[model samples]
Target chain A: MFERVLIVEDHESVSNSVKQALNDLGVDNPEHVSYCDYALSWIKKAIVTPQPYDLLITDLSFEEDQTVQQITDGVALIRAVREVQPDLKILVFTAEGRLEVIRPLIEKLGINAYVRKARRDTQELKAAFEAIANGRNYFPLQMKRSERNGHSFNFSTYDITIIRLLAEGKKQKDIPQCLQDNKITPSSLSSLEKRLNQIKDEFSFTTNEQLIAYCKDFKII
Target chain B: MFERVLIVEDHESVSNSVKQALNDLGVDNPEHVSYCDYALSWIKKAIVTPQPYDLLITDLSFEEDQTVQQITDGVALIRAVREVQPDLKILVFTAEGRLEVIRPLIEKLGINAYVRKARRDTQELKAAFEAIANGRNYFPLQMKRSERNGHSFNFSTYDITIIRLLAEGKKQKDIPQCLQDNKITPSSLSSLEKRLNQIKDEFSFTTNEQLIAYCKDFKII
Candidate 1:
């Protein structure tokens, strides 16, 4: 059980719920703040005190309000907190489903756990807390299962370049020229077409439009 | 308290949590199923029996698996269930945040309550259950505040058409021609520009790209 915890979330109901969940988990009287700047300041002041907060539960998106903030969202808050207290355990509880939005938090931020604000989140929260307590990193179960089932593809730099161009509303014929301008190898129109086809085939997509949409949804481009 | 409740959620962990929440709320031994079709069948069977399910708790999205379901998602299930058992109280528990996706459930389907699966959702769930039990429709608190604050814009069909075109990678300069082809009123480029600007100003977005992204994120298009 965590002795001290801080929650960063804008929604009052959500924050209250988090506090209740934490209390149920034996974390008594956890502190909460609505703004990221306030959370950062609290963390900064606490680190110099005799007892520091052990865990941070934060939501990724914060509704914009009248108060101007240097650290506006959860990602920025997490980064700032990491700089000040690198060893503090962080658990992200958010409704954001895009892989592009979530992948960086785990890989780059070195977060202890990632819990989606979805059905049965309390159970997941308890599981995440236990994992962190035992020095293990907890990720969403769906992501792990999908990765294991080969649903997550390894896109090459060339593949990503082509997909990104398409996402930017570039015509198929215009891609080869852009690739040639960038000095990427095998920049011919035929090679580009073949590569696109190969990538689509790997994902069982019938059209380039579907491939582009999938890439965007997954945040690959 | 709901004496007879049925939970339709795909995720095992989420379903278990929902069951636990129901149990805590004094609904003992609530029935649950992973697929929408199975849930529909269960409801159909239950309705014929002496005791009918009084409340239905469902998740909006179900991950695609080997099970080929006629009613795949929660929305469709709700619609189907409504047709068969019009009096059954329905409570949607999902992580979907887009207003575009959620508006229809409330406005068209006439769902009893909507609880977003986020932080402190159990509390919301209890509130929703109580509301439905008392014959009052319950919406997410954040949505209620946003609506009261005038943050929810009422976009007309014309607005959606323009935003959808932009989302489909259509160029701004080429939009007028598409509008003319479809015989939409005031298909002039200047009117298009004026309307686009008005929308941006309403949301304080400086660029068309930002507007497009906002619309997409909120599922407006």
Candidate 2:
């Protein structure tokens, strides 16, 4: 179980409820911050010290106050925090219910759990904590539905770069030269072809255009 | 035609090529900057002056240097520029080819044109300028193909909010009350149902879950 947790949320009521939830889940010594900047500073300091936070529970959006914040949003905060502490488990608690927004937080950003702010969000928070404590990534029911529909593919940065190039109107044969010029590794034709074919097979796509279309539709590239 | 254009690109070669392309298009006086902060400062200055730049052409990503920049990326720059000069047209010239990433810039961020930096990118740049000059939003061929596949939708902020709430685990019956609590307008159940139906019909979605799944997959929400 996570003995120490840090909650980053702007709403006072929500933050209090999260603390109560964590208390009920038997996790004590949970700290909270109202601003992303403050939270980030705390995390950075914790990183330098021996007792770093066991888990970071953060909200994606924060209400802008009069003072200008260095890190305005949770995405930037997460990226910065990840850079400092790569192994830290992150559980995002946000009112932003869009999968388009949160998918990257999970897939690309490597968040451990996501608990949406809704009617029974406290319950979900508890579940999220339990899941994270057990070293499992918790996906809400909606995200599970996305996975069932084949929208959940483990995409490497290498794969994304290749697909993005293709979408930029690069022909298959010419990709090697483009990659070589860009100094991207595995620029050989055989590797490119094999990788593209593998992606096509995974998605049941017939052509590069279709693959591009699918990627665009899903915002994959 | 735009007489004055501001180009924001970190790459020296790409910036030079873009300048040449603009010159070839018979549009002289295209100013270039390597840093987003410098580009934003120029834009801010132009806003108060009489001879404001007609169009802004920017790359999405900027290389980080030794000195920390206030406006680190092109998205932040575009947002700041849009706030100051709402009428100034924006044409994104970037190697970023992911529709998922750039679609928001077109639909939400209000960028007028996109020119992918690939083979014959200079030609595309000229075409983008021509489209913008003619008061048309230039959709790259890949983007056009996405629209053909029914990926394009005119999603209002309200619609996105509603769908996002649903994706966040809010029941249809509970949404109106939740929205009402948040002081959001059109909080009646009938309106919410009608809006959801319209969106489902637009995407041929049989259920709210499917709609959410589609939104997640396409990064629409």
Candidate 3:
């Protein structure tokens, strides 16, 4: 029953659907903007007014356009908005499925709900809205399952650093120099070899190529 | 309006939305399946019956589960269905936004229409159905624009081959041996160096790393 809602999304179709969902939920005339900057300004302007938006529904990636924008994406916009309105209920509606990308949003940004823009999204959106209205956080079931499975093999920053270097086409021998340059500890050849071997064993990967491919496929790198 | 519609999507929310859209369009009792194998069986069985599904609405990716499936993904399912029912209209309803992945479904598979699973997708799905029912093709507006912009810099097979190797951490000089093993012409170190330089110059990339990163970002390699 959140009456005042603001939508930040680039796609007209998506925004239209969100509006329709809000209307169906008895939340009338929810305001919407295609750009993050405009969304910010509206939120800022509404803060001084008697009527303020209590909820924000946003998409993560916005298609780049002719207009130059300081706040180009939803993550930045969310961060900025949190500074101004600390108590606003925020929901992310996006097509992004990567756990690596989404984990930080919930852990760091403290979003109230995340409903992926997929089939039966209207239902999902409504469910998320209901949860948020009742002061409960809503996360998709699949994400929870992924989190449980993903916890089995934890990827440390050091692991990501080495894997990212390998993905960037650096050979095993060349990684030590890059790591040393970055002032990362234990940059010796033997240490790097040991770490790579340990990681590969954990993942049951035979070679660096498989490990790199797996990382890329999972968006870990 | 198309009467008999078969929706092949793993996510219950998405399938429900598609059903809702189809119901709104006056197409009642549309069959739904969570697996591609089941979808194919349904289609195959219906083919012998008086009423076969006229349209196949499917998503590209399916969550892997305990059930073993021969036609694991939608692309394989599409290809399999094409063999049995060539005239049945196929509309790809997927979250995939990559031009490379979508282009093939249009050009090679000759799918009747494509509706991305996004905000306002119900509207788009209906619109796509209408177009396909009228014997026309439907491609998203952004996709058409991307096609126009994408035509400028074509990534040939040779370009992709070299870039993929580079992404796998192959050095420039080391590429000659890989090319030679594959019996690819111009396997000499000088030829590879020349090709790499030429491609970088076309894209205005100062280094191979930039070229590799660009290819990865755009899913060219």
Candidate 4:
């Protein structure tokens, strides 16, 4: 069990429900901070005495809309808390499902675990806690980035144009004309097709057709 | 074509091959660095001026294995670069395919693109560049954190036990006794069933029987 847990969330209902859930699961001494400044105060207090929480459960969004500190976002707050104690275990239990939010926190904040609020059931939280305590990492659900934007993975700008043109039903020969107008040569076009096929294989898709469809469905366009 | 490119690769042959590819594509102003210090030097220079490169292509591992600089690792490098220049385009062009590597990088680094070197085809790089320029992000192929560990997505620790026991043909009533003896309780069991249903929706398994097969195929036991 986490010796000292701090909950940094703005939603009173979700925070209270979490407290109740922890009690039901037999976790006591869990502290709660509903705002970033208060959390900062806690961080300052923890620095000298190391009241630095053993495990920090935080929602990614603490935007405080209509409040004074509306500019402070989730990633910035996480970084502030991190500056005080670099070794803290942070479990981002938030609703922000975008990789733009999730990935940067993982990269910048040194997050120990990721739990999506919408998809995760009760026991998954316990699993996340246990894993973080034991020095393992966890990511509950990942909605791929490309799907949201229908973008191709590791693709060049020309490749994007080609994919779009291809999706619009242009012939491969017609693609070279579009490319030649844009400075790509016939040899470059051949190399491009071969490489696109290879990238397609890495994604486990049968053809460029399947890849484009998956990308579009995910909104990676 | 990229006006000024920065390459953060360790291997000479691979870097040169990629450089050749870039040259073939008419991008000739690439600044190549096999070490972190040199890369950081270029980074400082880029910040001082506009940039030596418009895009940065980096590998996760570096040669000489620079000591104590966060720039030694690809994730750390992305973080540092992002801290200094929040909008620099970073394309991870590497072979580090693990989710622990890929997921965190995607989550934290805010990397604009990813292309596994071993998996690269001529067209994929082109595609990645195009996507990034058009303000899109890319991830190397995604692997669920649970799947890599041979665990079922919906199964908590008790669910795993129950699944294993069921797979071994244990009776339903006997299962509760088995769990009870092991400190797993009723609410946990209910939550487990609830979670299974959620996963059922996610993977379109439709039936409990199919869920069991999925668990088996994933080697949950």
* Model 2 bad stretches (over 4 Å): A1-221, B1-5, B10-37, B46-55, B60-90, B94-114, B117-119, B127-146, B151-154, B169-174, B185-198, B201-207
Using DockQ, give the best candidate's number: 3
lDDT of 3 by residue, A1-221 (tens): 78789999876556766787788889989998989999999999999999888999998998766778999898999999999998889999987766767778889989899987654577899999999999999997877656665636778899999878776667678889999999997899999999989997887765565566557656777
Model 3 lDDT at residue B153: 76
lDDT of 3 by residue, B1-221 (tens): 77689999876656766776788888979989989999999999999998888999998998776688888899999999999999999999987777778889889898999887654567888899999989999997867655655646777788788778866767677888999899887889888888888887887765565565556666776
lDDT of 1 at B169: 57
Candidate 2, A1-221: lDDT as tens digits: 88678999765545656776788888876998878888888988988787888899998887665668999899999999998889999999875665767889988999999977643566777888899899899988865544555555667788988877655545567889988998998999999999988987887765554565465555575
Mark the regions of model 3 whose C-alpha exceeds 4 Å error after superposition.
A10-34, A45-51, A65-70, A97-104, A116-127, A139-221, B10-17, B61-69, B94-103, B115-124, B139-144, B151-153, B171-191
Interface RMSD for candidates 1 onward, in order: 7.6, 22.2, 6.0, 23.1
lDDT of each: 0.80, 0.78, 0.82, 0.64
Best by TM-score: 3
Tens-digit lDDT string for candidate 4 (B90-192)? 9888655555456677777678887754323335666687777677876534344324553234456756766566545454445666777778766355655
| TM-score of candidate 2 chain A against the true chain A | 0.65
Clashes of 2: 0
Top-down DockQ ranking: 3, 1, 2, 4
Which of the predicted structures, 1 or 2, would earn the higher DockQ when compared with the native?
1
lDDT of 1 by residue, B95-181 (tens): 776566678988998899988865567778888998998889998667654445444577889998887776565667788999999
Please compute DockQ, using alpha carbons, for every candidate against the native two-chain complex. Answer: 0.11, 0.02, 0.20, 0.01
**Candidate 4 regions off by >4 Å?**
A63-66, A141-150, A153-221, B1-221
Better of 2 and 3 by DockQ: 3
The TM-score-based order of candidates, best leading, equals: 3, 1, 2, 4
